[model samples]
Target chain A: GIQVEQSPPDLILQEGANSTLRCNFSDSVNNLQWFHQNPWGQLINLFYIPSGTKQNGRLSATTVATERYSLLYISSSQTTDSGVYFCAAADTGANSKLTFGKGITLSVRP
Target chain B: SQTIHQWPATLVQPVGSPLSLECTVEGTSNPNLYWYRQAAGRGLQLLFYSVGIGQISSEVPQNLSASRPQDRQFILSSKKLLLSDSGFYLCAWTQYGRGRTNEKLFFGSGTQLSVL
Candidate 1:
């Protein structure tokens, strides 16, 4: 089993601000993903970066598997970006099953 | 395109009542199905996962159990519900095959269960 830790348990930002959320895993992982749980309780897939970097509009994520850490960057944040950001990872084991971090709550005020 | 369906949107039952939640995946065959629960103020926890028909693996020791009746259908059940079983239950699926990297998962809308 692997442990996942997320930093900045809570965050508050004004519209148009930027933020960076961090996730660290205890062991080597072959799968790492970032998710956004909206107010409606839907687990929205943000990024499925096992390694390297990926960008989707205003959000981007970088996973340094060698360093066992991943970062989620939110740029020009908007009110719609307010939600709980979660990072999950699956070890080098056979399955893509993942263990999740507690999450980082973001609140972007308009 | 693969999609997952979980229902009902919410449920309320007595502490000793039996419980059953259903999850079905469409547009895929032999996919990996999973059941996850998100407790209040906690992270998402993997309850059970099935790689194929009639196979299930539990992640944690709980009063709840899971079953894969079909290649794309997963069910979570409890003989007698407990107050602690109340939470947000989510169903997810991903591509499952030999040497295939199923990095991303598609999640269902989720069901909110409250055991009184």
Candidate 2:
């Protein structure tokens, strides 16, 4: 089993501020994904970056597979971004069962 | 397009009561289904996953159990519930892909369970 750890268990920022959330895995992974759980308990897929970089609107993510680390970047954060962000990964040897990290609670104040 | 459905949106039950949560996926065939629990302010924990009908694998040994009665249906059940069972339950599905690269998971709306 692989262990995933997220940094800054909790975070708060101004509406127009920028932030970076990091995730580190203990072992190599074949699948890596980022999800945002909103206040209403909706799990929204933010990114599925096993490697390289991907940008969606004001949110971007980069996964350095070789380094066993990934980063989620939020730019000009909006109040709507307030929620818990989770990082999940699955090892290549398994049947693709995801193991999740505790997550980073982000609050963007308006 | 594939969609997953879970109900009821919220439930409250006394300790020792029976529990059942249902999840169904549409627009896909032979997809991998999963049940996960998220405690307050915590990460999602994988409870059970099924690759096909009648095939289930439990990730964590608990009082909870899951079953796949149909290709697109998954059910989570508990004969007796405990206060510790209170949490948000989510259902998700994914199509298997070649090698290790695959598409992202599609999650259901989620169910909030509270055991008194």
Candidate 3:
């Protein structure tokens, strides 16, 4: 089983601010994803970057598989972005399955 | 477009009571289905996942169990609930045939269960 660690367990930002959330995995992964759990408890997929970088609107993510790390970047943050940001990864094993990090709680103040 | 439906939205059950939560996916066939639990202030934990009907993989040992009786339907059940069972339960699905490393996971609205 792979261990996923997220940094800065909590974060507070002002509207329009930018922030970077990092996720580090203990082993090589075959899949990596970032999700945003809204206030309504819906997990919204943000990025499915196993490697390289991807951008979706004001949110972007980069996964360095070799480095066993990934980052989620939020630019011009809005109040709607306030929620829990989670990063999950599946190791390159026969029984690989996604293991999630504890998650980063982000609060964007209006 | 694939969509997942999980219900009921919220529930409050007494300890030792029976529990059953249903999840169905539409617009897809042979899709991989999963059940995840998220405790308060914690990340999602994989409880069970199914690649096909009647096939399930349990991630963590607990009082809960899951079943995939249909191609797109998943059920989470518990014969006797415990106070520790209180949490937010989520059902998710992904593209079929990618069991080695599942594709982009899509989650349902989630169900909040409280065991008193």
Candidate 4:
């Protein structure tokens, strides 16, 4: 089993600020993704980046597979961004199963 | 576009009661279905996964069990619920891929289960 750890377990930022969340995995991954769990307990997929970089609106993600780490960046954060951000990974031989990190709680104040 | 439906939105049951939560996916075929649980102030944990109909895999040993009777339908069941079973249960689906590759996981609204 692979281990996924997320840093800065708790984060508070004022609106219009920027933040970065990191996820480190213990083994090589074939799949990695970022998710946002809103206050209502809905999990939304943010990015599917096993490697390389991708930007979606004000959110972007980069995964360095060789380093076994990934980064999620939120730019000009808004009040709606207040929630838990999670990163999950599936090791190369794990098939489609993904092991999740503890998640980073982000509080964006308006 | 694919969509996942999980219900009921919230549930309350006494210990030793039976529990069943249903999840269905639409607009896709042969998709990978999964059940995940999130405890209070914790991350999501994979409970079960199904790659196809009648094919199921359990990630951890717990009081619950999962079944995939149909290609797009998944069900989580428990014969005798425990207080520890109380948590937020989420259902997700992803595009099926070969060779162990995986796509993004799209989740349902989730069910808040409270076992008293």
TM-score of each: 0.96, 0.95, 0.97, 0.97
**Candidates by TM-score, descending order:** 3, 4, 1, 2
Per-residue lDDT, model 4, residue B87, is: 97
What is the lDDT of every predicted structure here? 0.90, 0.90, 0.93, 0.92
What's the residue-level lDDT of B46 in candidate 1? 88
Poorest stretch of ten by lDDT in candidate 2 chain A: A90-99
- DockQ, every prediction: 0.66, 0.62, 0.81, 0.76
DockQ of 3: 0.81
Tell me which of candidates 3 and 4 scores higher on DockQ.
3
For residues A1-110, what per-residue lDDT tens digits would candidate 4 score against the true structure?
Answer: 89999999999999999999999999999899999999999999999999999999999999999999999999999999999999999988846478899999999998
Off by over 4 Å in 2: B97-101
CAPRI level of candidate 1: medium
What DockQ would candidate 2 receive versus the native complex?
0.62
lDDT of 2 by residue, B10-98 (tens): 99999999999999999878788889998987788989888888988899899899999988999999999999999999999887522
For residues B36-77, write the lDDT of model 3, one tens digit per residue.
999998888899998888999998999999998889899999
- Share of reference contacts kept by candidate 2: 0.71
Model number 3 iRMSD: 1.3
Better of 2 and 4 by lDDT: 4
Stronger candidate by TM-score (1 vs 2): 1
- lDDT (C-alpha) at residue A75 in model 4: 99
Worst 10 residues of 1 chain A by lDDT: A90-99
The superposed Cα distance between candidate 1 and the true structure at residue A103, in angstroms, equals 0.4
